[model samples]
Target chain A: MEKCKKNRKLIWLTIYNELSSEQKSQLEIHLQACSDCQSDYEEALRLRRALDEKIQVAPTAAQLEASRAELHQRLLLLSQPRLQKSWFDKVWQIVSLDFAPSWRFATAVALLTFGVLIGNFYSRKAATEYNFYQQQISELLESNISNIESVTYDPVTRQVAIELNTLNDFTIQGNIEKPEIQQLLAHSIVVRYQNLSIRKKIPESD
Target chain B: MGNEEELLIRRAQRGNLKAFEDLVKRYDEKIMRLIFNMVSDAEDTRDIYQEVFLKAYQSITNFRFASEFYTWLYRIAVNTCINFRKRKTIVQHDSLDSYLDGNNDNWQILNTSEIRNPEEQLINKELSEQIQKSIDRLPARQKSVFVLKHYHGYKLSEIAVIMNCSEGTVKNYMFRAVQKLKISLQGYQQL
Candidate 1:
């Protein structure tokens, strides 16, 4: 049963006559004893004959000729060299007297140079304007230092001393969870510390 | 592979349009038949026919003479057809009855004068239609394999080369295609 089951699939190849000589002999031996396989083979052969009767429909000669002609035209176009302006035509266009080419070239260069000069002037002006705005912002930030008790700059040590006044004059030290201290520290960093040129400092008791 | 064909190929490779056209003429009929058998739609077949030759002409310079010119050409035709089938979203199912009723444009060509008896003609037409439908129902790869094998009479090895698959794989496809065709065509065997 196992052998017949496997041989059933080969029935197609057998009907198509694609089996090797040895396999064909083996299958022939199997077919002599196996009525079921024989019937399957017969069915496959019938199907093959039906498939063989299919008429190969060719395109009409007219269609073929039309396609050939179209393809030929397309191929001709593909093979043909591209149309280009001749060197004489290019030179004539460039040297044509309606507009003097040299004067046009000079005008183009002058315009480009003037455009570059104006672009450079505007860029420098914009940079200066940006610096001025930055300076104003720094001064504006400095004005928000109301809680800072005093700011002393030491030239010898190259340090700026910043003293802060608490609301109750009590030194409040805690974690970053303290909102007031966090706000004060943020303001000090953004305003005084960012702009000041300070290196090292030590608090002095007064 | 003939000396004359070789000369033509050389000339075609050298950009001789006449030589290329001659090559097209030599194989266009068979190629058209093969494509039409694979794709029953006349319009799609015509488009693929034109595309195959145009592609061959465009890429003639790349012909390295590694295989027969026809095999190389068949590769292009098969690939183009496969891609064309893939690009299409709707499958065009041609009804054989409608086609045989003189509605199809190619009906006149298919209905040759060989069969004078109307009854026999009808039977033959139905059988052919059944066969085509079976072939059409196959998956694309199996369809190509079956068409190339049975319709074109190409050997399995040759089919493998044209399909760019192993011979075993081609045989497997052929087996599955034939099995499907057998089951689909079981009722028509007595006729």
Candidate 2:
């Protein structure tokens, strides 16, 4: 009787084939030994048979065919896009799961082309700027001054002179601490060093 | 699902309307039956049936094939029926007479068992009415569990997935549903 109470749940599960074989075998053994359980089992089977008999509620072929037609109409409407798809939905379709291999390939090629074009444009602009600066410096160094013959500091005159052999030999002499003189001397040396580096980067004409 | 059905589902997931329609034809009958047994009304069943497949169509893209398509589809059907019931006024458990008015074709005997006599036929009708009333009386969750378990013949574990409840909860529901029907039908015999 105590076991019968526990096995009652199994009665329905057994009727439905929801029990494992072990539990089924156990219930089978119990049903053989227990008359009350046997009646319960039989009753459950009768109930299932009756439910099975009465409740074959599946839409008949005609009914199903009708539902399918209606469902198709509704699905047609459902699959139809709104006047417009939400931008996010469009983007998600493109960038996410539904993004096609062809689209991905196109996207990749587009991006790579954009990157190359951007890189090419900026590099050419930068190279042009660098070349322009180089030309100006080389003109200052190679054309404006033939050579620096000497840079002299004279204590008696309290001045510094930078003598050059040029289109015409000239001297720029001023107080050594003068801002203009100090700046010019610094600028010439810096430009000359930069011109040397830029020269190395330029390909030598064959 | 067989490989062919899986192909159909993949196509459907990608928004193939024809493929989705094929899936609908394949599964809608069972879904309609589940709905009919659930709501016990043809119009309501049709509405829920439409809602179920429509929702499946709308949301098929989200289906990751994490589970079988039928289980996922059943979840949609069960929830749609439950929600449709909740949205309408609760018609307290009562006569299925009016509900059965236009639903004659929904009833089919499993074996087409020939009736011996009118008396037996009357008893069978009474038994059928009683069974429907018993179903109508169960709470929504319990009724879903009951339908999925007994009518749909899903194992408790599968029902657990469909119901989105624990297996133990499904078991308890099945037990209660059985007990209710057993009590309700006790007065009738051999119908």
| Number of the top-ranking candidate, with TM-score as the measure | 1
Error of 2 at A117 (Å): 51
Off by over 4 Å in 2: A53-55, A84-206, B90-111
Q: Which pairs of residues collide in model 2?
A: none
Give the per-residue lDDT of model 1 (tens digit) for A108-143: 676689899999999999788656645543554445
- Local distance difference test values of all predictions, in order: 0.75, 0.76
lDDT of 1: 0.75
Instruction: For residues B32-145, write the lDDT of model 2, one tens digit per residue.
Output: 878887887777787788888888998998988788889999999999888888898965432444323445564444433544566766666677777888778888988999
Question: RMSD of candidate 1 to the true fold?
Answer: 18.0
State the displacement of the C-alpha of residue A64, model 2, in Å, after optimal TM-score superposition.
2.0
Best by DockQ: 2
Cα lDDT over the full model 2: 0.76
